[model samples]
Target chain A: MKNFTQFQWLKYTVTNIPDGFDDMYWKKSGSLKISFIILIMFFFGIIAKDRLYGFQFSADYERTFNIIPYIMKSIILFVAWTVGNWSVCTLLDGEGTIKNIFIYSAYAICPYVIQIYINLIFSYILVRDEYIFMQLIEITGTVWSVILMFSAVKAVHQYTLKKTFTAIILTLIMMLIMFIILILFMLLIQQILIFISEIFTEIIYRLRA
Target chain B: MKKFLIMFLCVIIFAFPLNVNATYNYDYMRNAIPSQAGYNVKNVLYFGMNEPQDIFFSGENFYIADTGNNRILVLDYNLENIIKIYDKFIFPNGKETQLNNPEGIYVSGEKIYIADTGNSRVIISDFNSEIIMEIEKPVSEIYDQNKTFIPEKILVDKSGNIYVISGNITTGCMMFSSDGDFTGFFGANRSGRTAENIRNYFVSDKKKSRRKRNIPTGINNFDISEDFIYTCTENSEKTSDIIKKLNSAGKNIFSDRNLHFGDYQSEYSNSGYKPPKISDIDISENGNINFIDSETGHIFQYDKNCKLLFIMGNISGQSGGFEKPSAIETAGKNIYILDSGKNNITVFSETEFGEKVHNAVDLYNSGYYAETLNLWLEILKYDGNYTYAYNGLAYAFLRNGEYKNSMKYAKLAGDSELYNKAFQEYRRIFLKENSGKILIIIFVISGIILIKKRGEKF
Candidate 1:
């Protein structure tokens, strides 16, 4: 058990979810490296879901293709989810740290990343009439990941099911608050830069006069 | 000295305007691509007509409603000779009056239907210039009491049924029987389902009552085929129902097709985004629907299935372009557009590429898919980005049992429905051809599994 690799531990965590998370919390068996790899995979998975899907199923307009939005969305969403959950858990007397929350959350969404590639493959194989199968596969992956997410949060914070749900609701609210604060911060920086530039322009005009 | 000479040459070149006949059509992705000219300006007939509002071809002659001249000019089939001009007519009361701004004219058989708009009456005259029948404003209860009847366009069917479109009427084209009896309205445009209407649906009854009722835009013009009346509207706010083909029952048959009739993307102007204002519609001899946009002065020609074949003309001070294209009429292989601003009839003769596209479209619509194969292939050689040609080639290949080629063209055409049909056939053929090999593999795997089980039992 001590000599088990990170890959083996990841497999164990996926197979025996509740027991695996329990061990991660008590014995500290989970690796942050594995979580980082999962996060990177999630980023590519989001892109592949848009760009690599079959033509019939793809709704993206190729002429207006931009990769920056996809990159920003994935990074911002993942960071916000991790930080929001950590902040909520800290205020609720939960046991999980920010690092633990990030690792567990990334592990929870591993099924989603794997299923995106599977869905991309199925899109090419199935015709439009057989779209129901693709929809079912996508819904199953999302539902399974959601269940895994709930379990991971419960185990990581060592909270009851009700407390875990409340914490999740508060985390979502915290994310929205953080987004508003980010907008305000950006506007404040813009105003300050404009003011400084105007002062420089005024100084140059005075010297010229 | 050399630079001065070069500059002088540049000024001379700039002084003379280039005759650039730039014709374009939208591809499968709705991107405008410069295409081969489908039509060329054969001639511009200037007969001293002022602001002709409408033009109609009756297979023998061309009738122009010279609105500003207050007369109708009948030109020969070649459009070079003026056959006759009718400006005065004796009324039923023995009163002689000249036409007051005849805005619309339609020639059916030996009869000439004129929408004398300023007089608020439709005059049905014959080839002899005799007033056969005069249809004034109807005095029926269904006709609105407060509204004024200002006939803007008029057409007569084979059964002598007169369809009149009033400029102020939004209900539809006013239909009248042979004896000038008012029938019910025909082909009224459906009210636009806008965001405000949706909100009103959920709002309180008091608030809803306070809001003004939404009315549909009036039909600008219409043309008749065998049993259908093709109408076009000039509603800039709504794009849906811009063009409608109504049967006898006044129901739009194209309601289910979800087709966009004009330019999918709106053009930006100083005011705002300007949507296509489809002012006139005319069906050609071979069932091709031609629409002339008054705003852009562009003529959009589509096949019977609404597949765009060619887009010609523009708002330019050139031979092929028009300043204000009010009417479009097709005779034989040439298209005649009445430009009220230019005060001339710009005739567009079909080019070699246009003839090929029309032949292929006609064959495809007539269910001769196999024959259209060569024509469509040739057309693709001329214009590779033509999506309609790709669609025709896909159907031709499907009829010829070339399922793989059919799928390829269908995908290129961006027709997923056609692609699915071809893919289904290809999949069936693939499975049938490999059934024996698949069966052998399955049997070998099961046999090995059974042998392993027996060995373990022993």
Candidate 2:
């Protein structure tokens, strides 16, 4: 084979490699997996929102739980963020599929496991006294999280240090493209729905009159 | 093949839970709905071509974290959309023109900081979105020294230090120098690093399941104050979201898991009841917190002590109240709530009573001593029963060195309980000066005695 140019080499390294992104070879499956993860995240978000605001949904506790719209907003935000992250990983990490990105986005949960429990037992007890300790824990979590993310990115991209860097840049561009496409699609869908709803309402009103 | 298997196993072992002695209980806080009418929408300010994830307001302009559109939507004071596009920097090949997913947006001093989440880097640009500088690659061990970690939100302090949230949701907020140096990091789970058990909780599969399968509990959103950082956590125990106060170094000064809404218990067994979620939180310049509930469209306000002060907005139809409110902010006497579902912004003016109470606070925040005094005086004219107005007037007089006036209003602000702290400070100065008055009284008495004695001698 002819020697690859820097451009060609970079592309080969980021997307064409198989070690890191072998599973994503099945693009459709990868995308499905990501969708499922997103669903789980959404459910968890709801649970968190309900718990945070102390919403029991009881007629007795209706006032506390009526904050569903706020919870929904959080869920939507979480979905958007996770999707963005997955889209980037899939396109650039040599996986080039939504499925792999979805699988890896679960990696975020790794750090939360520690954060939640520590918060449960220690956050309140430590109070002002253990604030410094809490800060350290946070720093450590970030460091560990970085390590985990690096491994995940490396596994999916299967590239050298230089190649992985290139994948990151490419993935960003891909995410941008995907984001724009999704937005356009959503806008189109919204406009069409609005138009149809208006026409249907007009017909109903006219018939009644 | 055996060697490869061994390496894979080692990787798994390496990533295993590092902390294990931690106990987690999600049943402590009960989840339940507090009311039927729920929260009312304040206002919704809608813009951008697609889903707006994060938004920043500075001066007369608003910047959208238009995650869906993969670009930042610029808006003017009238909420009109502005165009900001850039096409520079050739990637891997000859590909150029247009940026990738610009997720998080931060504008400061003519420079815009973008998380550019897709690129796994932070990009700094001019107001026009032109690429100025970038932290594309991890140069140091500051953030995932060895692997590629995604960068989320970005913040630039008054001192110009750049702070980026990287890693995942469970980790604490990370920091970096303006020049792209990995200065330090803070705010993970409580318990020091010596407690390996604490670290284990962060990496446990069961814990992950609870977070993924259950509810999220960790630092998700944060805002910086002059001396402290206010942050919110997505808690699993169905109470209220946690509000954390951190020092300048990212150390937790105090954390209130249930910040605003009082002790609420939710009956989660029945699927009918959906608990309220705190979608986005905001802190006004004066340190008042406005947290929006996505489900009910209610905006809850809390003081620095995490006490519930007021719940603005009532459930209603259409854009008047809220369909699905996302974010909140305050400008002057108006509160703006962004209703994403209705794609409209609902605006609410402060209550007459709330406005009167805030005038004093506003003057205090803006450092207008005379003006603050005048405003408080004006408020007192309308309603003389306002204790806070008196207290505020006392503070104004104190700031202006009107001690007597300060004492008068200070007592009204509940001098013993409310202004007691400030009164003590004033007392210190009053005592030192009291000696001068005592000397004058003594001199006058002696002079009177001398005049009487001279008349007796005559």
Candidate 3:
């Protein structure tokens, strides 16, 4: 029973973190691939709470949840992080695979998700003056998530602190490039579809004549 | 011979050029067009007046502060003839005194208050011309002895507390007790957040106190509205509050966050030549806070809520125009604007449309929003450009529980606060009807995720 617990239950305990977690996360064998999307959804959903939490958003009525945009934003951010980080990590000779990077990055979003759910409940219960408490919670959650991301990258890639920070900065620049490219690609596809339709219409016009 | 003199005087009075009043209503575009419900000039009360600074109407009589003439001229309501001239003021010490540039006059009950500007005194007298109280420069130790107490305007509250405003004194309106004791200055102007002031953050207190702060945003004019005192400043910089509705503590409770004094855009005209200069403010009987901008000669009328309802007059120097507007006082439905430079008073009477708009605004301001809705709708038909009517419609709709319609009107008027409120109510209605279903879906999704997670682990 102890041996099974050591190998199985040990996957999520805090004792095997920083070094042990990153070593396992760098390999495909340690992949909890499904949790990645779930955590991404949570990461975006937690941020939506910022738009919802205080008088920043309109407060005429009780807030209504809109999940579609939050989900889409999370997915986009996840893709941006994975692609950006992988490219930079490859150049820096970091050991982590793209799959490991994705899983670790998503796992870092865990603190924000838990904080968001707690806040979603508290927002209804708390009055306007008590909003300082809500602000403190939000800031703490964000800071925790950010710190986790920094550590996650360092651990997964087995890189030094200086190398990790350098990679992170480069990742941000890469993210912007990838995002622009994606937009251009979508526009190109749209233009091609429009051209094809115009050609088809021309053919149909000749046939009708 | 006596009969001939009487007839001659009658002829001269009749020959006096009394302008028939012309009124202009602001179209949606805020252009003052010739509209009905306007006063003809009626009569320009120029009798025995020279360089007049202020005018007050009380007890069916016009009290003209004939500053240059150094006397308070009592004229009949029609400005046809003079009642009495209050030039000589008898001191309690049996000494004869006279006004130099008496700029302000207030007749409250049996007591008459005169701001004797040249003499630096406020003479409180009865209708019988018997001097009761004389408020001289406050000899209070706190009083800035260097600054002369040249009272330009005066107000006596119900409790007999005297409020006096002097030029170049930023300490605030000097407040005197009923017994003529200097209580203190009330409602001091706030130091504006200018670049010069921000730079003063690094400055030591001794240095800042030594330097003359840029004119200190002094009060240009003020008026009483119910229990509150409303003041307007003509600060060229748009940093500090140009207007304030202050309470008994001298705190502006009705001030919006960073309260602006007058029309947000074009304080003068579309050309934007002049800033908002409230030469005078008069409260209508219905609590409407109305004031005239001396710069543009424009009378900006606002409801008690500080929402502007109408703007009239101009500095075009034509008919229904003014060279320099000095003071504004409303008697009955007529608004008398004293133009100091032109040396004449222009009277603005309400048109039919103006009366209707006033009625709607009066109703809404006094909290009868539901009743004023139809009146506002009628106003829109005549002047679709009127922003007040749209605001009225938005408020009326919000009050009547028509949240969606209210939101639409607010959006049209570009009123974000009202729109947010209506949207909130609409959201509440939606949530009330579907919160249970929403909860079920959320729970179901979470349950599925939990099951999927357990399945993966096992």
All predictions: root-mean-square deviation over Cα?
4.6, 33.1, 13.9
Q: Write the per-residue lDDT of candidate 1 for residues A127-157, one digit (tens) a residue.
A: 7788899888888878878888888899899
Q: How many backbone clashes does candidate 3 have?
A: 14
**Lowest lDDT 10-mer window, candidate 1 chain B?**
B265-274
Indicate the docking level reached by candidate 2. Answer: incorrect
User: Where does model 1 sit among the CAPRI classes?
Assistant: acceptable
lDDT of each: 0.87, 0.56, 0.75
Per residue, candidate 3 scores C-alpha lDDT tens digits across B51-77 of 888888885899889899898888898
Which residue runs of candidate 2 sit more than 4 Å off their true CA positions?
A1-209, B1-48, B81-97, B137-148, B167-169, B189-216, B238-241, B256-276, B303-308, B314-317, B339-344, B362-458
Number of the predicted model whose lDDT against the real structure is largest:
1
Tens digits of lDDT, candidate 1, B1-458? 99999999999996554544567788777777778778988888899999999998888888999999999998999988999999998766677778999999988867788999999999987776778888888999999878888999999888989899999999999999988899979999988576887797789999888878888888999999988999999988877889999998989988899898877672323453358898789999899999998887778999898988888778888676789999999999999999999999999999999999888888899999989999998998998888988999999999999999999998898887888778778878988999899899999999999999999999
How much lDDT does candidate 3 score?
0.75
Candidate 1 DockQ, CA atoms: 0.33
Q: What is the TM-score of each candidate's chain B when compared with the real chain B?
A: 0.91, 0.60, 0.81
Best by TM-score: 1
Task: Give all TM-scores, in the order shown.
Answer: 0.89, 0.45, 0.66
TM accuracy, model 1: 0.89
Candidate 2 to native Cα RMSD, angstroms:
33.1
